[model samples]
Target: MMTRAFRTAAVVGAGTIGLSWTALFAAHGLTVRVSDPRPDLDEAVTEALTRYAPHLAARGLDVTGLADRVRIAADVTEAVRDADVVQENGPERAEFKRELFATLTREAPAHALLLSSSSAIPSTAFTAQLPDEAAARVLIGHPFNPPHLLPLVEVVPGARTGEDAVRAAVDFYTSLDRTPVVERVEIPGFVGNRLQNALSREAVSLVQQGVVTPEDLDRIVTDSLGLRWATVGPFLGAHLGGGPGGYRHLVEHIGASMQSLTDGPAPDADAQERLIGAVEKAYGSAPYAELSETRDRRQLAVLDALSETTGTTTPKEEN
Candidate 1:
């Protein structure tokens, strides 16, 4: 029943996240005005759009004439003028964001939906200075890295945000074929990052303890947990792991062992060096740009296979 259309989107920031968002908006047929202080904004954005076009096409999105729809703006005010949705991907500094949001609240049209691409900073951190009415339209639309490919957009609303605005944000993302998961309660790092850090922490600990080399650790993940999690999440995997007995059976049998594992020591400074060295040796030799392109291509292929088998597209694909 939620029906909303975003015809023009303003992407504030010309960094990686912002550029990816610009490409995504253009692919979805929205007129995108990108603003950033960088002198090379036009060249950078154009290149990013070009890089992302094939990926978007592979995901079944229409990327025809995508570059023509994007325009580069000199400042935030110019970018957001007449924008239906303002996706801010500014610097993570709280003070800077507070000032930036205040400007957005003042200059942006009242009907405009102000969404931030902040990862850890909550909406309240910046919206605190805005008027109640303006604050109500602001919320977080945090996406994983490479927003053009990743479909998970965490829609976290501040305490003062309106329910209608949240619903509209969800509908807007859904229209773009994104899976927007609403965070009912605001928490640091939202949900995805928190879960990611939890696993990363353990991974680092294991390597620090000399239990596994970084390459071996990564291979284990890509082969086992990553493959399984790509299909079913941990909870569901646990449910299946219990056979016919279900989650209750899992807890009764392995809960104590799991608790013990959780008590493992955190990684220390030495572990950091070992992890860095191992990772550097494993993949640091290749140029990051090449590795990133390879990663995106492989991700697309995996998603294609997943879609064929599951009768549902991966988060990266249009639903």
Candidate 2:
């Protein structure tokens, strides 16, 4: 059984992320109040729940009339009045977020968690207009494309964000069966999007340069790097690649060669210099043999799951 740290949730905005969040919240047994200025907010919510209901059921959540748990608030103020957490999925414009948060901080209960679905905008940027007290409770809760399926939720806090609020955010997401990775620093695009942007840049370059067609490029990544990354992260993957010697050996032998492989005219010297240190700082303490075994186990588990999905039956055709 899972513990629900929160009961009432106010989803501000009813767009893609907002709609998915609404469904996920309700599926997790949280009373959801959704606020959006859209005239078709009800239809949107219905369609989203209808689409996500099956997926939620596969994940062991009850989908029978799950829409009954949701309420469409007249406005943000009414929506957040009794909310235990307020998730803002308003426009990405910084000014819009700045203004939206002003109202959220004022209208939502003092104890209510304030989260934003901003992909690139940092919490500090929008929360700047807020006073210290309100800003302390505000943070970024950025999710991957579809919140209902993906488990990751980047919990990014501003300079003034309180430790309690950060901890609460993690607990809140965990309660919803979401994986909340609390970022140690606040940066635009946070970590996920930054890594995505970096990979995308090269991907576009490769396609444009006629190195590989888009279709084949995607197949290559999805079959190779994507599959590998699904188990251990890039950092851990590199650490494991070193076999018995670990990351230090990989750096000593092929670090320069790997850096040369990038398309950059000049590699970021500072990052290049810090590469070994940072990688070591994160993974050096782990016992090499045990870590390798763990990576292998994770890799096999992912492969086993893939075989079930891809071998016995073909994957669902993407629309």
| Every candidate's lDDT | 0.86, 0.90
C-alpha lDDT of residue 295 in model 1: 47
Q: State residue 195's C-alpha deviation in candidate 2, in Å.
A: 0.2
- List the lowest-lDDT window of 10 residues for candidate 1: 275-284
lDDT of 1 by residue, 225-256 (tens): 88767655665556556555545566668866
Evaluate model 2: give its TM-score. Answer: 0.89
lDDT of 1: 0.86
TM-score per candidate, in order?
A: 0.82, 0.89
Q: Where is the poorest 10-residue window by lDDT in model 2? A: 310-319
Model 2: per-residue Cα lDDT over 124-213, one tens digit each: 998887889999999999999799999999999999999888999999999889999999798899999999999999999999999999
True-structure RMSD for candidate 2: 4.8
